[model samples]
Target chain A: MERLGSGGREGARRIGEVLTWDPLVRLTHWSVALLVLLNGAVLEDEGQPHVWVGYAVLGLVAARFLWGLVGPARARFTSFPPSLSAARLHVDEVMHGRERRHESHNPLGALMAYNLWATLLAICATGLMMESVAFFGVEWVEEAHEALFAWLMISVGLHVSGVILESFLSGRNLVRAMVGSFHKRSGGGA
Target chain B: MKLAPFALALAFAASPVIAQEVAQGDKIGTEIGAIASALSERGYEVRKTEREDGKVEVYAVREGRRFEIYVDPETGAVTRVKEKH
Candidate 1:
């Protein structure tokens, strides 16, 4: 088995150089991350920037969903359809020391992707509803938005933990992958 | 860190007037209807009200501006008003 992080030694050995993350994938990922952090923690919610950031996050989610249909091989939703059996198998492999590193995303990662997108959509929808004339001052809508935000925070925690765990197990820096670069054993393991 | 407790205490401090405004035994001091009436008197169209953090968090609109007014349950005073951005 090729050692994970062997890609760090570019001169001594070149394994497989693949562009796993497309520009849009990397862009949307970081953009959403920054916007969420800004709105959720750094920025004041009463400021105009907070609303604009929410709108930007909504736009990014919409674009990402659309890209999942027409984007590159790795970006397409077909690349990692959510499957319980597949996730179970991945879990089993992890337990048995037979888990193979995925070229794009593992089963659990795909589930998290779908979950984050859906949760964000819910948060944005409620947020937008709260701003509408009819729904303005509606308690349930605000409560729902708040509840979804809490879920989003939980999802974020899971995502970070999953990334860290996968990186350790696969020996590949997943963070580097999301930023448009990753190392793989060329023509060796599919 | 020391200021945190002070701030928390300040936030929850109830004035003497507030204690006299509502009964001591009753939680959520003033009735929701009374809170709504008080908000309406101030030009707010009360949309919804919930008991939160020992206060009545009223969601209301006034002259088309939405506001989240946290009212003291006992005194029915608008402790804080957060307008939508």
Candidate 2:
């Protein structure tokens, strides 16, 4: 967001690269992204690979949640507490062209991130249950797994769109920030 | 992104076809209860019996070992037994 002044984009006040997401954050983010895609679309659901991928996803998510509790200042859950009121205020601020800086995830992003994690965990739980003798070929268990997966797919679409929209509004490549240690030094909220 | 839902729909649509295809031996129907009893006689505690891919799959446990016992729907003959991990 540091480039907002030089870029001459009105209401875009942030500029230059600043350290945002930590290495673990970026690693888990992308890894989960790939694994979700593989398990959701690429791999055969009945195949062993899909089950393994689900386990990997659950482990990564658990690690990420732990990091949120005991990680760096910016990566902690306190930095981006999920709150509906704050998210609503953020929307109002955006609509009024009043850009604000957030040290971590913006309120809306925080809520979505939490949603993604919770939904992912539920998906894994259902998947694991299906492998047991009790739930094997159980109608409701299978139905729940598929339904949760569909919800995950929808959440992923919203996530990508939100990233693009936030990047455009802030005049910074959020993608670049998540990809590496540095982000453009600018006044923008992820 | 779009393909996920499409694929999911396709999966749901394809399952009923498998349910319709279980016609083994002489096309004489072997009821679910009959299959369960047949498997129970083999010391298998039957949990579920479902028609899949032209066979009646009986999910059972024998001596605490989980198994999938595939039976010919017509003759109720044990065709395959797979131990699940």
Q: Relative to the unseen true structure, what is the C-alpha lDDT of residue A60 in candidate 1, on a scale of 0 to 100?
A: 98
Model 1 per-residue lDDT at A164: 94
**Model 1 vs. true fold: TM:** 0.68
Clashes of each: 0, 19
Candidate 2: stretches off by over 4 Å: A1-15, A18-20, A181-190, B1-29, B41-47
For model 2, fnat equals 0.12
TM-score of chain B of 1: 0.60
lDDT of 2 at A91: 89
A83-137: candidate 2 lDDT, tens digit per residue? 9999999989888878696668878788989999999999999999888866776
Q: Please, what are the lDDT tens digits per residue for candidate 1 over residues A39-150?
A: 8999875567777889999999989989888877678899899999999999899888889867567999999999999999898899788787679877688889989999
Tell me the whole-model lDDT of each prediction, alpha carbons only: 0.75, 0.75
